[model samples]
Target: MKKKIFLVSTAAALFLVACGINSGISSEQIGLRKASLENENKVVLADINYSAAQPGEASVYDRSYENAPPLIPHSTEDLLPITKDNNSCLSCHDKAIATDVGATPIPPTHYYDFRHNKSMGDVISDTRFNCTQCHVPQSDAKPIVGNTFKADFTNKDLLKKSNLIDVINEGVK
Candidate 1:
């Protein structure tokens, strides 16, 4: 029994040593970037060019996936820093005024509170006030990693619009 254990241990050690000697990977080859992990100076990001078109002039892009936050089609240069006191986005995107200005209205989900599960009645829920948390302006920068994902919308209307409120509890027990 002792001889069998000794031979098994010896074979396992030899196999591990052989693997280390034959297939050792360097630090540079460990990551997808194929660059030295210690060097930040060597890493260069692709140039990001956001939309320069003003609101109502830029074209809306199809949703990346079902219930995905729609990207800001126009430049947000002058409408940033959404504070509690001032949210420039509401000037155009508020439900009451959005249609008049040809801007997409803040969805019904924004008016309903998920935590308390009640309607706020004409007020944007505090949780949904920060539009940029989920939504971002579109950029022309190339992706660092390749993706082959294609969004499969159940219906054509879901391609551009979100029905998160309608389907939020679809599978929940």
Candidate 2:
């Protein structure tokens, strides 16, 4: 009887310790809660899902046109993507060279003049330098779930990418 009591006590203590360990851990640490995902009290799913993709799970942009956004179609050579330090979108489009490529130069509207600091007076700066901050990949990615889409413009040549409002409405449906 004493042995059984000792064994039972040990099991109960182990169980309590396990529970205590988790209780002491912050919700973020345990992933049950995240301040990062809290957008006005709603848990944002985009920031939470990071999968260790399977081997070869991500193609080398090898998807077909029906399954992909139009691939860059040409080499963005010497281009400085907005993530210049890490981006590749502007290496070819920066006004310095777009004329050579017969492509329009990046617009004046695209630049942010950060002349606030006296030292930076009259200098246009790349604010929010991360290209993804304002421009998203033209991923033409398929919907994760089934989507029945009909083009608003019946002409094949006129089918363009959806704007923000269009994408949001698609999500709602």
lDDT of 1 by residue, 1-173 (tens): 99999999999999999997789776678777777788867766667799999999999999999989999999999899999899999999999999999999999999998889899999999998999999999789777689999989999998889999899999999
lDDT of 2 by residue, 1-173 (tens): 99999999999999999998878765454454454332436565453332233322332232222222322333333433444455455644465766786544554434534355323223225673454455332334344568675435433332332222223335554
TM-score of each: 0.79, 0.30
The Cα local distance difference test for each model comes to 0.91, 0.44
Output the worst ten-in-a-row residue range by lDDT, candidate 1. 39-48
Q: Taking the candidates one at a time, how many backbone clashes does each contain?
A: 0, 9
User: Which parts of model 2 have CA positions greater than 4 angstroms off?
Assistant: 1-87, 114-124, 145-173
Score candidate 1 by lDDT: 0.91
